[model samples]
Target chain A: MILAVAWRNIWRNKTRSLVILIAICLGLASGIFYMAFYKGMVVQRINTAIKTEASHIQVHHKEYLNNPDKKFVISNTDSTVQIIRSNEHVKAISSRVIINTMAQSAKTGTGVKITGINPEDEKQVTNLSTKLIEGTYFEEVKRNPIVIGEELANKLNVKLKSKVVVTLQDMQGNLTGAAFKVEGIFRTSNTAFDKASVFVRKSDISRIMQLDNQASHEIAILLDNNENLASTNTSLTEELSTLDVKTWREIMPEVSLVESSFGITMFVFIGIILLALLFGIINTMLMAVLERKKELGMLMAVGLNKTRVFTMILLETVMLSLVGGLFGIALGWLLTFYFGYQGIDLGTWSTAYESMGFDTLVYTQLPFYVSMQIALMVIVTGIIAAIYPATKALKLKPAEAIRIDL
Target chain B: MNVIEVKDLKKVYNSTEVKVNALNGIDLTIEKGEFTAIVGPSGSGKTTFLNMLGGLDSPTSGDINIGGTEIGKLSSSKLIDFRLQNIGFVFQAYNLIPVLTALENVEFIMQMQGVDKKQRQQRAKDLLIQVGLGDRINSRPSKLSGGQQQRVAVARALASKPTFVLADEPTANLDSKSTENLLSMMEELNKQEKITFIFSTHDQRVVNKAHRVITLEDGKIISDDRKNE
Candidate 1:
């Protein structure tokens, strides 16, 4: 009976109840959509970093940490690659001969880390071929083929098939210069990373650096299962004691920092939205209690105990909040799912997003746990919001309340 | 058997600016099956006395003993339980819960008593029928006439099978015909069920029909009259 009364009481002022419902629904939708957008942007950053640069795990010569010169080339690169390929979880592995050099075009010169890689191996590990924006990716380019980022190409004012001079120190610490023709121009989500690196053939760099056949400075591995990242890196480190192995998270701590900080940012955003809605709910319920003071008083006079009275008011408040919350969650899910498929294009803010290491095209992805957490948050907010109004209703003295006019 | 006893009942409305004595040292007793009217002019303490008697308000210093228990000594929650079990109240405003039908309003008190739904339904229906509102049991208070709504309030009060009924100006808003009909029905119930009916009113029609009349002036009983059959 109390539940029945509480349910009917909400419809007493149909317009007011409807307005509250709409407010809660819209508030939740906007809040959840914003959270999904943030999550999408974060996920995009992590995927870009892993696919275009880090490749899950990297192994370097132990001496490279102290002296990253040409002298620190891996002593047994071929055997290491063979061992890595034997593991089922090891999806792909690429060896690289890395050299820091200054590249100069007709227009300008800038510092760059030139990576020498086996084109087929690099293709499997990083999918470097797919990022090609212009020309080909080392396809039948016989001599001195190089791939540069679009931003770097623009910075140096160079185009496809353009000749550029790269100056580096050889094994004997003597300045060595080589001219290279650009075979590919690629662009990635991170403009800073794209502008700082270039790729070339490992055989060409090994001959020029005067290192042994199949010798390289770095080994980048892409795993079949990312969830095995920690165990795989640990196993590789223990098995190959002479080299240093690091996961993507360990190799680039900034990406991990951004990932963890986003969780807190999501909670803060949700809290602010729910707090604003809380006061509106409390105010509406308070008014309802005051408006029905006489009726409530008569209920007490007719033998409805204080506890029952309090529970009824609380039940009404929770019903109102949950109704709105459930609708809002449904609305938020619809929008998120639809946009997750179609993707939200922030093309107008592409430059800003790229600068911040995020992709412009965000696919709103909310995990099931996040959705459940949001529902729990709304229910808790509802229960918390009901406390004030329920207490006020409990404080009314039935003796005097029954006599109060209007 | 005496159903209610009041001893030196006093009620003072105290505030920072003034202290008004609403009820001043009143003493009274009501026997079983008595239809009594506590009549007074405005500000004569009739409503205050009725409120104290029903355990709705505590007296400043008095003992209100109903069914051999002093309600003034009960806790707030205990007093409410006591009222539910022993006393019924009919208000002047015909305070039937507006959200409920006449049947629901009548069933509410018995529901609060934790009576079985089947028994509560039958008892509520029979009470509404007794009050001549059986046909309008499905109607909400807003859909009923002033007299019909009040009759529903009366049925609601009696739903718990209380020992007594306290009606405060129950007919103050009724027409002459409705007032006469209400009084006749209440008198018949008072005799048939052997239930005590106490009311505070200025209506002469109610005072005339009551078996006993206690008149108050300035918070004191000025006349206590009983009608002989």
Candidate 2:
């Protein structure tokens, strides 16, 4: 019966009840949505860098660490790749050869850093073939050609089928050169990479760089799970004595740091909302006690123990908080899921977002556990706010309480 | 035997500037099942007297023995238990909880007293009916009149079947007609249930109708008198 009375008391004043409820709801929504988006974006950042750029690990010549420009210095990359492919945990591998050169066009000239790769094997490690914009991949024509970055292509004033001379020094300090047609154009996630980098056939690199008997300077390794990247990198480092193995984080420190910073920022954001809601709920309960001072005092006079009065007020607070929190969680979850599905692309926000190193389309996705845990946190926060108000109500003097007119 | 005994009852509130003695050693006694009234002007310690007897307030220096227990010396929690089991109170403002219905309000004290479900419902229903509020069982305090609300409070006071009802100017907010009706109902309950009714009031009509009247002024009793039945 006391519980019934307590429940009824909370709803007697509609406006007060609503004010408290909205406070709790807003708090829960802000916390839940921020957590969901922050967690999702962090995972997305790691995966994108791992699968589309760094791969799980990259194996480079021990000499490459000191001077990566060393040519014709590969130590049978094919046998090493075969050894890695035999491992069940290994996902894919691509051999990469890069040469710093200058390209001259009819209208313009610019310095270019060209990466030589086997299109078939490269797709396995980096999935870059799909990033091609104009013309087909060079593999489709069975011809050795160069794929230029957007910035390089713009500077050279070249389009599909444009021709350019790639000039550079080969091994043994020999000056050598190559000519190739532009077969395709591609964009990198970060525009800096697109501005300076170019792609070429791996066989052509061996022929021009005078390494016909060797492969590229490094090999990129990928795994189905980016979570395993660090462990795999460790294992490879232990097994390979002549080469250095680097994980995605070590290869891309700046990007990984952003992920960590984003995570901490999210936690702080939610903490502020949670703290405000807790106090809001506590304030509402205190107001309730003040408003009903006379009645509470009378209850004591009529043989109600102090414990019962305290319990009634606490229960009232919990009911108000939890119900409000649930409503807010629903709204936040709906919004999170809707945005997660269709994703708010940064396309229109391109100029601004590009500076932040993200693509035009920024997709959003959240882990199921993240959203569920946030809802549970809402309930806990509500319970915490119930304490002080209950204690104050219990300490009321029965005589003075009954004396109050209202 | 007297159901209540008060001797040399004194309470002093020591503030920063001075001590305000609310009660200056009141001496009184009431026999079992008696209907008594304590009358006093404002600031004359009528409320202090009631609080001391109900175990809701402690006397600074006094002896209050009610039903064989020295209530004035009990701890706050023990006093609460004692009040729940032995004393019922009615306040000047009716003090009906606005959110509870008449039935729920009446059932509240019984719940605190640890009465079982069926017993609480049956006893509350009986008391509300005795107070002539049977039809308004589902009505909250806001939906009831001053007299009706006071009657519900009275029913709540009696729910635990306490040995006595301590009413502190319970009719202060009621209309004359409602006050008359309330006093008559309380009188009927006192006669039928043989439970004591102790009221502190300044209303002349209330004291005139009482079987015993204790009048006070300036924290001291001026007269203690009883009337023939």
Q: Model 2: runs farther than 4 Å from truth?
A: A1-7, A23-44, A63-66, A71-74, A140-142, A212-214, A234-242, A275-283, A300-315, A368-395, B16-19, B115-119
lDDT of 1 by residue, B169-215 (tens): 89989999999989999999998998799998889999899989999
* Candidate 2 lDDT, B41-91, residue by residue in tens: 889988888888888789999899999999977888888889988887777
User: In terms of TM-score, which candidate is strongest?
Assistant: 1
lDDT of 1 by residue, A1-406 (tens): 9898888888888888889889999999988888888888888888888888899999998878568777777878989998887777899999999988899998899999899999999999996799899999999578999999999999999999998789887777777888889999999888887898999899887777766776788999999877899888888888888888888998879988888787688778888988999999998899999999888888888788989998888888888888888898888888899999999999999998898778999999777687677778887887898899989988888878878887
lDDT of 2 at A271: 60
Please give each candidate's TM-score.
Answer: 0.93, 0.89
Judged by DockQ cut-offs, the docking class of candidate 1 is medium
DockQ of every predicted complex:
0.67, 0.59
Model 1 segments more than 4 A misplaced:
A62-70, A82-88, A234-242, B16-18
Considering chain A alone, report the TM-score of candidate 1 relative to the true chain A.
Answer: 0.94
